[model samples]
Target chain A: MRIVIAEDAAVIRDGLSLLLTTRGHQVAAAVGDATALCAAVAEYGPDVAVVDVRMPPTHTDEGLRAAIRLRRDHPGLGVLVFSQHIETRYAAQLLAEGSHGVGYLLKDRVSEVGDFLNTLVRIAAGETVLDPEVVTQIMGASRRTEALRTLTARERAVLAMMAEGRSNSAIATALSLSYGSVEKHVTQIFTKLGLPPSQSDHRRVLAVLRYLES
Target chain B: MSFRVLLAAPARKRAWYELGYALVSLPIAAVGLIYLLVMLLTAATAATFVGVPMLAAGVLGARALGAVDRGVARALLGVEVPVPPPFRPRPGLIGWLGSALGDGAGWRAAAYRLGKPPVAVLASGTAASLWGSGLVLLSCPIWWRIPALAHLPVNTWPRALLAGTAGAVLLLLAPWTVRAALLPDRLLVRALLGPTRASARIHELETTRAQAVDDSATALRRIERDLHDGTQARLVALAMSLSMLKDELAETGRDDRLDQARVLVDLAHRNAREALVELRDLVRGIHPAVLDEGLETALATLAATSSLPVDLQVDLPRRPSAAVETIAYFCTAELLANAARHGGARQAGIELRTRNRLLRLRVRDDGAGGAAMGLGTGLRGLADRVRVVDGTLKISSPPGGPTVVTVELPLHP
Candidate 1:
């Protein structure tokens, strides 16, 4: 995959670049801060941009804000926003305009290299991927909603996994269930939450996320 | 000494100015006295509805009189008295009336006004007599030649010369007498009409203390960011590199030295992760970014992350100043940590609200309650931090069961 890296920390930035290069992925551009990230994205037009939530020049959500802008200006470009801590409000905001080609994850998730790379690949392929921590926080907040209260524990788990942008097959593998059973749980969750049934996984994730956030 | 005294005598122009000020003050003082008398009468009859408004108006009038006197002193005597702080009336009519009636500056001004008339009379009388007698006696020789002085006692040249000499002495002393008389008046105006020296110093300290509080908050935030973007980031990178090396070593499929390399990499990774966690905690302790959202959200985050089940309740009508909010948030965080660590708390409750412009936080724990502030520097440090804004901290714990810690802070520094 062609990627652009925007991070203020030199060690993290260089390490990430080296890691991606060793894996045979093209790192088109690497820069620091939001302004340079935007310029690099425009100049390189990479397949995806990996952004840290906090960057130089007001290290509070500069990367998150730049990612949002990138999503708006270059709708086809994928953005994966990573942060040390998961802020539910930032998650809600990032997913506000539907979850296509967007990802929000904890930086700690990078420890699991294979899974993190898979998430990046999924996001670059125009899919939504949210960290499990984000899903848990949103679930904790949405447990009080009437729609969520009606779900069984099993169905709620399926819905949370769905909100994390897991496909039915992946959900089956995680839960040790058949694909058909995972499909049934997804359908039941959509029906219970009064969301329109959709065949697209990205749209399904968005619908589940919107319900949970509501 | 006498020659030096003559040379250092108060300037004639300044003496004239003082005389003018003393003469002009009498009528103003009389009017101020009448106004104060009416105010007092109205206050005495304040049970009647009409007198209440009258009394309020009287207090305002007294303050205005003080302002006029301050202006006069500044313009004539070159004595500058700083204006006192204005009355801060509350929202309702009753609050306004109460504050107005209780205004310290207004009462002081009234007292100054009442006392001014006597001082003015004395000063003006002495000035008039000194100038008049000095002028008459200095022309004694000329007056003795006139027919009016021919039958008077001062008809001889030697006597006339003696009178003239005495007159010269009196003229030299007139300026000094005028200055001496006006010195007490200047002190009175400064004491009554201006903010006292102690209160002025207090105001200055309050401003600087508020700045210090804000500067410390900014500095802590900077430190947290520096650690987040510097040390923590570097540690995470180190862990990732170790992970990559571990992967590379495993992929080579050489079993002889692979196990040793794997163990070393594992140790490095674990240490890096541990360091990252410690740095993360240190950053959070310095200043939580969630606090920028508000005290409620910050406290909620703290409660959510606690080891024990925390019942959190926040009922604030308005947010406090940034410095005050930071202090309150840290106070609660420290207290919660204390409860969980030392108190053996099974469950904790945090309650926050604002009352009478004070932000109040209460942290209670159902624990073995023998906590004393003197037991550790944590509580003492928090108390000192609270005192920066003139806030208070109170703790109550008996040996057996429950502990409750309360903190009260002003909405502003």
Candidate 2:
């Protein structure tokens, strides 16, 4: 798949291009500004575009604005915005534009290379993959139910892992818990969160989130 | 003429707005007020020598009226007219009557009162004609799409064109012409209100002194608040947590298993350190230890560590309140830091002196002068610190080399 990257920092851009290229994806274009990124995307016709929320010429929301403009101008284009700060307003706006073809994630998540790439691929494939941190921040900001407050530290940990799209087996390994125990914790989380039983990974996570948020 | 140049004064000098208001408009108004006052006093004497009853009536009328004029002037000019100066004579019918009759300012004030009717009519008429016409004329470009001259015997495109052209001409002349109309009112106001430049300076200094004293009091309160809120509050929470650990230990009767007690002890020690550190910070906020040793001692420590070589001089024997000393120390330290880090100044120098009842601290760096703190809060915060202490801090770091910062605090008793 072809990808265009717009990031002001030369080192970070080089690293990202190197990382993506090594992952069997083509870096169609790489640039340091929103305007150039938009032009490059139009020229290269990339399948997915990864943009830093802060790019040059007013190192503020220029890149996010370019993202929104791209989405408006080219509705078919897939976009994933990475921000140093958890500024969810842009993320919410992009998601609200269309649930598909868009994803917003913290810059740190990219360090978890394989998982981050999976998110990019999901978004490019027109699947919704909201950053769990962003979702939690938004839910907290909006002052939803006391589900977060009532959650045991361990349960919250388990939920965070699930939100990261970790498999139950992966979560068991990470948490140093038996697979049986992880399964039980997942069941308790769903029941405590008031989510109806579901086997589909995406639906189960969404249901648990909807319960916690509401 | 591009008005954009007038607008784009660079980001740093956006403070030109504040400077224009303070240095230009205020002093001009103050001088004008003094002028009117002198004229009124002269007019009062001429009235008094003419008739005794007339003198009493004129005095009574002037006192009541000068006050009214100040309010009117304050509203129109957007200058804070101070509360009217106190009426003379003590609280008694006889004294009040005599002071009311004898007050020369009242008589002069009355003359201005007398002049008000004609002045108001002129002011109202001119303001309306100028502003209304200016707005209408300046708006021509927006409405010129329906192009025509309207003030013709018949409405037509040619007439609309003529009208629009006239409007453009009128709008072009509006600024100078309006300034002219306002010039008299501005002049009249300046003559009646405030005081002489020297007296105004004295008054400004006096007010600054009052602010300094208030700042000193506020500093004390803030220290007290910090101690109570930060260090004290943390200790309170720690005490409660320690008691909880004690309760848990008592219930368990297992000293060996009391890791929580160890944690609480660690927390208590941590809290103590935190309190001590915060107290030191509070003291630093009051006066840095380097500065506490004295100004020269303080600057020496700063110079020793800074990238640039600093030449320090302290000629003042007595300190100007802890607040003033603190501000001077921090400001000089910051200036030195800035010089070293950003200015690439190889050398920086500071001079401190207390003379003519003012404490002056000047720091200069021989480096790139374009160390624009700009709207950066650190420098502005330093500036505000000076303001709070009833002192003035001037920074002149124009591009090229040699940046200078001067902070002057009054030594008013």
Candidate 3:
């Protein structure tokens, strides 16, 4: 996959590009600030653009706004918003356009190279990928806490992963469970929450996220 | 041209006020003069035991009348003279009399009372004569028909017209003459009734103190941004490098040395990330980066992260100066912390709004109260901080329950 990186910090920008290049992905363009990020994405048409939430010229959500604009202009492009802090409002806004081909993750995730790369690849494949932290915040602030309490601890964990846009097999691997067991938990969660059964992974994520966010 | 000038003189409200001031001050000065002269004569009779005390009482009386004089000037002449500091007498009868006699402000007021009568006499005399004669002459065409003026030379039509023309010029000159004649009296009132030298110095110091407070806020913001952009970024990058290095070592081999190298690399990565977290917190403590968005958003973030539930309401239709915003943010942060840590507050509410060019931030908590500025440095320091910008902090916390803190700040430094 080809990637464009936009980060004001030079060292982080170089480190990210090097990490991606070493992993056999193409580093198409890397620049600083929201404007340059837009230009690089336009010029290179990369599969995924890793954007820092804060950028120069008023380092306050410039990159998040730029990502929103890019999502509108180029619907097919994948955008992964990376930041040091997790702001639930920004996550809600980013997903408001549609969770397809979108991702929000903490910058610390970059230290876990395998997981970070997997997230980027998943986004490039037009899958919704939210940081676990974002999912936790949404769950904590969700209005249906009373209903959410009905699920068992393991079922809750599986539900959280599902809200993060994970496939059944991915959830099974991460939770050290068989594929059949993960599917069973998913079914139970749907029954307990009275959610309409979603057949596809993307639809399942949207349904679960909407339930929690609402 | 003369007719226009004549109409313009009475048309100006300021001219009318000044003319009134000139007329009114003469009677006030005459009374002050008579009283002063009696006091001086009584003070001159040192053969009696009442000489010195009588003079002290007279000076004190002048000071009292000076206050009334200032009010009169402000009302009519539009002169705003600051009231001088009140007299602080020493203990005992003798000491009080001695201090009153030596009081500089009182002596100056007495001198003004004596000197003002002469200046007032001249100014009022000039204003009254010019205005009175001008009005009489300008209406000569009508008044000249009276039988009492039939024998006068200027009672004829041609002479009356000439006199009326002269009257128009004098009417124009009246305002100017009154203003000029009153200049010395205005100076006398200002120099005597305004604040004394010590209070003036205090005022100067307060201005510089406010400037210093603003300068420090700007400097702290700069330092925090620099740390955020430079040191914190570099630390995160270093952590990333260490993380990558650990991965490289893990792939290299199953050798003991390689495993040890990987462990060291992991430790370094963890430590670097920890350092980054610490630096981020320190930078925020200096100046929250979220504040760059605005105080509303920044306070929202603060409320969301607080240990106790915080109901934050900010209605600032217009933003305040950056320095004032910074001060207000810190004040809110400290107050909330106090509510939780000291007051054992279950919940807190922050209300920020602007009214009458003032930024008012009120924080209330439903907790064990008894919060006092004397009890801790937090509230006192906040008071000092707000005072620098001519702001005020008020705390109303009873012993039983809810604690309310209100901070009022100017929109600008």
- C-alpha lDDT of all candidate models, in order: 0.83, 0.63, 0.86
Candidate 2, residues B59-111, lDDT tens digits: the string is 66655556665665565455464444455353445565567677655655644
* For model 3 chain B, the run of ten residues with the poorest summed lDDT: B300-309
Q: Model 3 - which docking category? A: acceptable
Which TM-score value belongs to model 1? 0.76
Which pairs of residues have clashing backbones in candidate 1? none
Q: Between 2 and 3, whose TM-score is larger? A: 3
Q: Which should have the higher lDDT, number 2 or number 3?
A: 3
Cα lDDT for residue A27, candidate 2: 96
Over 4 Å off in model 2, which ranges?
A56-58, A69-77, A111-122, A125-132, A142-145, A164-170, A178-183, A196-214, B1-413
Q: Which candidate is the best by DockQ?
A: 1
- lDDT of candidate 1 over A1-214, digit per residue (tens): 9999998888888988998899889999889889999999999899999999987786778899999999998988999998977887788778886577899987766655667788889999999998888888776655345677898999988988888988899899999999999989888988888899988888888777766655
Per-residue error at B182 for model 1, in Å?
A: 2.4
Please state the error at residue A52 of candidate 1 in Å.
Answer: 2.6
* Model 1: how far residue B46 lies from native, Å: 2.1
The value of fnat for model 3 is: 0.40
Tell the DockQ for candidate 3.
0.24
Q: What's the candidate order when arranged by decreasing lDDT?
A: 3, 1, 2
Better of 1 and 2 by TM-score: 1
* lDDT string, candidate 1, B173-264, tens digits: 88778777777788889888987787677778888988888888788878877778777787878888887887787788767578888888
